[model samples]
Target chain A: MWDYTDKVKELFLHPKNAGDLENPDAVGEVGSIVCGDALKLSLQVDKESGKITDARFKTFGCASAIASSTALTELIKGKTLDEALKVTNNEIAEYLGGLPREKMHCSVMGQEALEAAVAHYRGEKPPEVEEGTIVCQCYGITDTKLKRVIKENDLHTVDDVTNFTKAGGGCGSCIPDIEKILKDLWDGKVAAESAKPGRKLTNIQKIAMIQEVIETEVRPLLEKDGGDVELVDVDRSKVIVSLRGSCTGCLMADVTLKNIEKKLKEHVSEDIIVEIE
Target chain B: MKIVYLDNNATTRVADEVREAMLPFFSDLYGNPSSMHTFGGQVHRKIEVARAQVAALINADPEEIIFTSCGTESDNSAIMGCLNSMPEKRHVITTRVEHPAVLNFCKTIGKRGYRVTLLPVDKLGRLDLDELDKAVTDDTAVVSIMYANNESGVIFPMGDIVNIVKSRGVLLHTDAVQVAGKIPVDVKKQPVDLVSLSGHKMHAAKGVGALYIKRGTRFSPYIIGGHQESGRRGGTENVASIIGFGKSAELAGNHLSAGNSKLIELRDKLEFGLSETCPEARTNGDTENRLPNTLNISFEYVEGEAILLRLNEFNICASSGSACTSGSLEPSHVLRAMGVPYTAIHGSIRFSLSRYTTDDDINKVLDVMPGIIKELRELSPFVK
Candidate 1:
């Protein structure tokens, strides 16, 4: 059994507003059968009052999706259109207790549908279109939103963007887009840093400085912890490092290496490689 | 909240009498049955008694019983033991819908240069005996068939199958896990070379089962270790669970006739109520040939998981063909092999009754079923 919360189980057992509205003002559909879940939501918005008078939904998915849809309907019913637009996916999940981490997308889908329905009712185009050109094809995320996310979250790699927005993880077709976005952010950061005095250095000089820092600062600390690190070849500003001794088999080796890399990047160049052998 | 358990075909609650019979072996009677001391000798004698108890239920000799870990292990031992005994024989026969325990083993042996023919079943889950006869050849080593399917509860004609295989001088193994306690099975009357039963399927504990190897049948030990099980299956005895199984077998023999009729009546009542209340509902397997306590039905349009969730609200426990495999989106392989239509595949539910299930339990399920099905169907995309 998946350790479902009591609220999730209650909503699954007796889901409120679980049928299609007869005369809905707007119908919002999201997800698909191939994606493992789908939803069909209908809303009855009062034209003069700009308020949602009724909301109903039909979900074809697992417990989390069903519960999220049920809660989403209850959250928006009898609420003004402006208030409905302010509802977030986190709020939806919290309404039905907390959803499992992997199932957080279920609540996110509810928020997406609600936004789409409200957008349709107000005769305004969906905000996702006005956001900008899509940077991640897997999730259809726009470049402007991705840039804002990268700046706000301080993401440095393609994988970082994937962890934040689930952009480059699926099929890896959007990897180049993720890389371009990361490089753009890094270049912008580097330009800002170089504008200050005593921070600018050539690429080759930066690599040498990083290597010296690892051997002096990083290697001594690792050796004290009964481990050793060897520097491998550096290519295209990516340093490869191989761990030895106790670190070779330890579960914490990856974490330790990542922390050292983060430190080296801060002191040296942000684009410098700190390879572990 | 009361938790009702209706998934008896999956497993059963251990009876109190059986548990009491096993307590002594776990505590004061802990001894190695193979040792030469008086303590070991007494424990060995108790094992003999258990063998006799198991044999009496199946109408076989005590010497013919071989203790195994579980039904799947018993199945593997029987199938592999027969193949090892007749190394020259290359062909094996089995059904398409046998449990993965048997089906996967057959597939594994097939990869090792053996000819395996998987026989098909009708829409009602009955095999064509004539097709079985045609599949047999001079190179056939053994024909292993299940006595009753776990999913559909449809009983195969093991007697006729035994006659066919025995006439050909080929060995036959029948997996009687589902039918062992629910129905009467006498190995002396049924012409089979081997039969398998699990204790947990009855009112005994898990981790213990018995395989009946008919006297004079040629076989080899699948598990090679100590001289236990007459050098056939070698391992330390699972003393407590084996004793519990012995007590369960005895109780099963005494109540076999009465339990069958009463269980069938309750199962029929539940089946009729569901079909009458829900529109376009129908049974999945053969009515007359199924286990008395098992009922499989497909409620049109509504998915099984949605129905199960609604039933859970009322604390009415049961299982579904599709709901059990929730993470995976594929329909059941058994239903697909039986050629069940795609429209009805996701909507199937299996309600398996046991001796413990009462009339009130069936009535409670019947009371909540119609409203649950109607509500789910209204939300279903397939419902017209």
Candidate 2:
């Protein structure tokens, strides 16, 4: 059985805004009966104020899918179209206290429907059906959607891509394609970093930027867990750090190091590597 | 809340008699049957008695039964054992709707340079005998098919399969885990080369199964260890589970006719009642040839996991072939092989009754199922 949270169970049993809205400004539908889950989202928008007054959905899916649709509608109501568009699939999953990893595609479906609805409101082509090569034949997932989902979720593996987007989950013939896409994505990230405007940084400037990133980005997150990181040295692209407080000798210290390295890579140089002192 | 369980195809409640028979082995009789001393070695006699009881249920000789860990092991052993004995033969044949135990093993073997032919089933989940006949070749090592599908409860024509594979001069194996207890299986009457049976499916405890290798069938042991089962299956026996399996098999053989009648009555009641109450519901298998205790029905528009959750609210337990329930992106391969419409496939629910199921249990399902399906359908966008 799925380890559904109580909030998910409560919402699934008695979902809010479960019916289609009458004469809505925009309607977005995604998935299909063949896919074993589908959702039709309707929004009642106040055009003058550019705000969504109401949101409703009719879904054909499992408990998690229904709960995800309900969460999507509840999260988007009373927000502007732009604000609603910013509601990521992760936020919808977080709203449900997190969905099972395999069922993450349900949240993705919810987000897709919302995007489709907003695009419809703007009288534009739905982002999902945009021109792209079809990669997953079973699910009809396209390469564009796969790339976007991979970037949004920071997905590194084909299995993670399947869980998030239902790509490479069926027949699995597109596994090689998914693997190529992931390789290209991370590889392109490194290439783009090299080609970035600030590829060359003075040693003093690089050290200052690293300290600033740790103080502003990495340290706060560590501080939340009653741990900290102190910069020990910066040799070339390598940033040596010492763990403090609860972080020293912690089992998750390696994971913490990876997080610090990821932060440095994002804010400083892509070649930044964090090592424990 | 009184629990109503209708997922017998998945597993069953260990019978009271089977449990009681096994209790002594866990404590007072905790001795290795291979030990030299009488206190430890005498338990081998009880194990032999168990071997006899399990053989009697299938009408095979006691020496033919080789105990294994579970049905999956029995299946793996039957196929791998056959292939190992006949290394020159590189082909295997099976049905697409088989349980993953056989299907996945075949797929893995296929990657290892073995030619595997997966026969397709019709819309009713029945195989074409002509296709099976054509798939067998001189290089075919073994043709392993299930006696009954776990999801649809559709019985294969094992008698016909035996004749076809036998005439083709190839080994035939049947995974009879689901059919062994619910249906009467007389090995003498329908002579197949190998047959697999699981204990838990027949009200025995889990972790014990038996594979019957007919006399004069050349085979190799899948598990190699201490000389056990007369050098067929090795490793120390799962003592308590084997004892329980023996008791359950003996009890199953005695109660087959009466229990089947009760199961059929309750199953038909649930089927007929659901059809009457729920509109646009369709059954998913060969209705005429299906097992008496199993019903696979699909409700239109509503998804099965939602219905199952609603059933959970009423303390009813059932299972679904819907993709969401199984954590897959597609409905059951059995339903897909049967060509069930997508509109109904997501809503497929499999309710398998056992001898313990009562008319009142059927009534609880009938009483509450319509309201749940109706509510979910109301929430479904597919509903017109």
Candidate 3:
């Protein structure tokens, strides 16, 4: 019981665009039998117009994996190769009324097969087979692919990276490396834009800016730990807030507050001070 | 749709006689066995009868049986009990294919600075006795192994294991949850220190299990509570389920020899039918040395969850070792430890039968399984 949607079940039972195309323009293969899921995408491309006249997939995986391949084939047909390349893994998941978080790697596999197929058609090296520093030795996932999927899916935690790209799901020896990558990405995003220094913001603008940063950056991390923070008031450089839910009366509240203040300083302003109400 | 359940190793249907034996205790006989009054005191006598019935299934004395909540508690009690009693011994030996109850506990203890040696199995899921002989040391506290694997149905050489571990002057515990009623488990023939048994694996009710601690063994209680189970385990007893377990044991013992022959016939028929129709399918484990009513077959190319779902459409219930079925990213550890190929591991299906399984059930599974595997293989990318 994966809690699969009706659309997923319907597509899995009677998948559209199944099997391989006879003498196709290009064939793309992604994943391997050892990984428990793989897909082979075949395309019929019109040579003059560069439009995909037909697309079919032969997949080896579970219900969600089969449904994802079906959705990918359906999404790519009747479009130019460039337009087909723009379809994200998220859209394949959305076409099936969303997939389980653990099975998101299936959607990622579908997207990878599409890219590999187009790369083959264009006489370029298939990106799926391109070599890089392997982060997950079990699945052969590379650091470059990990960073790309993390950015594309807005993945915040190492668990999310595993769900999307299967980077740290086996043996778990690379989790520290994944943590460092996440930290580097977060730090890079904050350091790239630091409120343009000395742009004096009005009281209302500062409040709204802090609120936006907290919602976008701080809240997601806190919610993962079963806690919440609400902005109460802004007084000059000091910002007041209330810790709610599991955050209240927790022994790690001080550490959490320090982290929050650090995030506020990195994203909002240097003089920003956080105080608990 | 008529349901054909081949997942008996997961759990079995409660027998009619066992259910009838349990119904009285839920209301009319709802009396604490420890009460001082005669009405409640009468219930105590019935529990002792159950203790004798369970003891009779295995060739242990009635006093050796310590009723626990379930098989997991019995396993935990045996391992933690032995470790706590012998604080000086820090090393333990076990196999890689044990049930999670024992494997996970050993892993937790390993993190806590205890030495654990997990013996590896060969491709046929057979233990290397020479490796076991060398692994045992004076510092070893206990050696725990399962009687038969749940997923593969591969039976280890428990008789040889008992001799090897016992000769080392160390305690040995066997998780016999899958073997007690399905096969003969005679404590007299092979005297192990502890044996854990589950009721629901037989035709008994859930929530009731028994652990046999051989007399004069160093032991400590895992759950310390109110004075019960002779202070080895303490809690108010699960009265109804225990009674059902007693009745099921009685029934199992009554027809053990006769029922096994019939089970073997049906299991072989189902295994033969599937293998004949799908020549690419291969049976896993040491088929010659497995349980009579268990068959674990693997089909290449197709994923197991996809095949199982298609089988479900025909109301044919079975179990699989696929990563998708268990919410893990890898197939079963049992299959993995045996070096089963990834091409087949993801498609492994286990069908465990029981005495109640009829010819029609086996026929139903045989008739529909080939079609399901064939359909899934067509959709697989690896299929040529």
Candidate 4:
């Protein structure tokens, strides 16, 4: 049903590096059995040369998933960590001759494991992805990862994002977020990048843009820190604000106030300053 | 490659006799039944004979049988037909495990300010009759339920459903596409208002289906054109398929009466062998009340798509609820509605048999399945 190539079938039937390394130099684990597929990739590298000596995987998934992990191990063998890091999921599917379109996420699982494993090889933690907003909770896909994937792949639809990263593929409660990310990438790519921040604006246009910046960018962070902010009034080059909840009496109130001011100036206009009423 | 097809519930191999009956209609008897000439009139007579045959299968009058394109059309016509007839009723009741034909249709109608109540089923895929009794109110328009589940082959107690619904004076429709031929379905014995059946499921050609509206049921046309099907359905009839369906329905009647020991035996053999040999393999659904031809099994620690692909190596045909198989992220809705555990849901595989299934087919599946399960389990992180 998956339209898997014979090479994929060959790799899946008799995976070359099917078991885990007992004392591997690096390990990468991505996905979960709960999501219906998971992959654990382990690598043994020559410490002096930084070349991968052996690569192995333990996968729980469909044919394409197993094939993807197996293809990943074969692709990275004898390659340096830097060289292996450049191998993408698309390349893994291509090396298998081809995989089904829907199974592209399996290849992504491989790429994620490879990245995590390479980070481990460097004695560094796999970059924790919770820094930004999570756009897809089903697979824990963050806004940062979502934007990077969209721009890299020129993805135009939520379904395209789903195929690449398994985002918006389950529960679908985050589809609005994925769609927002998609909208940002779809239109924001050409507009936001090319549009200069200091473009001339009427008082009304500047006020609307300031409000958009506050609601979209500034509010979420404040909410997470047990505080909330609202714009009481906006005058020419001066924004009046009220900080509610824990922020009203916090020891770091001045820091939080400057943070909001710096954010508004950087994102909206450098001339604008914040004042508490 | 020798294929052992156990996906009959998806579709059936057309019977040899049915094909033979349709040959003449496609070539020499290509006269349009709507024509006035003697050649065309004879074709109309044959269509009548076919209608009678289809009616006889369900014990309905020939006039009451309205032929349509397929089972989905029949289901749409029945449910939509009722709503169109009585615009005041705002609610439609159905089960959570219905085929997408009825479920999706209700969803669209729900968007149009219609309330849809999806009654839940037990872990065994059995609907609670008491819930149905309470859900029907003055606002309820139509209650649509399937005769037998396509995936599990578990039969619903339609008689009890009919009794409860009819007592409330509400209209009832049963989507009998999976049950009409595989089991006995006599509309005359029950007070049901409507029933739908597909030709292809009963070994007839595709592109043909029929709906039986018990005479005197409030009715309207869903197609809304031409006088074909007595103005109930539009467009010219699919002549060859209708005739083939008639011939197939007659054969199915005889086949049903004679019993389905081979189907039951082969189904049991396959179910028993796989569950016994494959460790952690278990069957889903109620084994006793299901159709004789269906056996759904799950191999714990091994996902379904892998098992199916491994089975494909031996040219064995089947289907699974694995997310990878359907390109969706969840298992089968039927299994989920029945509260099947998450551990087993992804690994569920459905092997539906037919009269065409042979002992050799069962043996081939049994021969290859354990190895397939073992091989996938070996690669699985959950297994070892």
Residue A15 in candidate 4, Cα distance off native in Å: 2.5
lDDT of 1 by residue, B148-221 (tens): 99989999987898888888989999999998878889887886999999999998999999999999999898
CA error at residue B58 for candidate 2, angstroms: 0.7
| Model 4: DockQ vs. true structure | 0.25
Better of 1 and 3 by TM-score: 3
- Candidate 1: what lDDT? 0.80
lDDT of 3 by residue, A8-66 (tens): 99999999999989989989999999988999999999999999999999999999999
Model 3 TM-score is 0.87
The residue-by-residue lDDT of candidate 2 on A1-277, one tens digit each, is 9999998999999999999887999999999888888999999999799999999999999999999999999999999999999999999999999999989999999999999999999999998789999999989999999999999999988779999988887888898899899979896776475443365889998898889889977897777555799999999998999999657655568878998999888878899888989
Model 1 regions lying over 4 Å from their true place? A28-38, A44-54, A60-62, A71-277, B1-3, B88-90, B110-115, B323-327
Screening candidate 4 with a backbone cut-off below 3 angstroms (N, C-alpha, C), the clashing residue pairs are none
After superposition, the stretches of candidate 4 with alpha carbons farther than 4 Å from their true spots are: A121-123, A127-129, A189-277
Per residue, candidate 3 scores C-alpha lDDT tens digits across B22-98 of: 99998899999988898888888888889999999998999999999889889989998999899889999999999
Candidate 1 global Cα RMSD: 10.9
lDDT for A114 (candidate 1)? 86
Q: DockQ of all candidates, in order?
A: 0.09, 0.34, 0.36, 0.25
lDDT of 4 by residue, B149-224 (tens): 9988889998899999989889999999999888888897876799999999989999999999999888999877
**DockQ sort, best first:** 3, 2, 4, 1
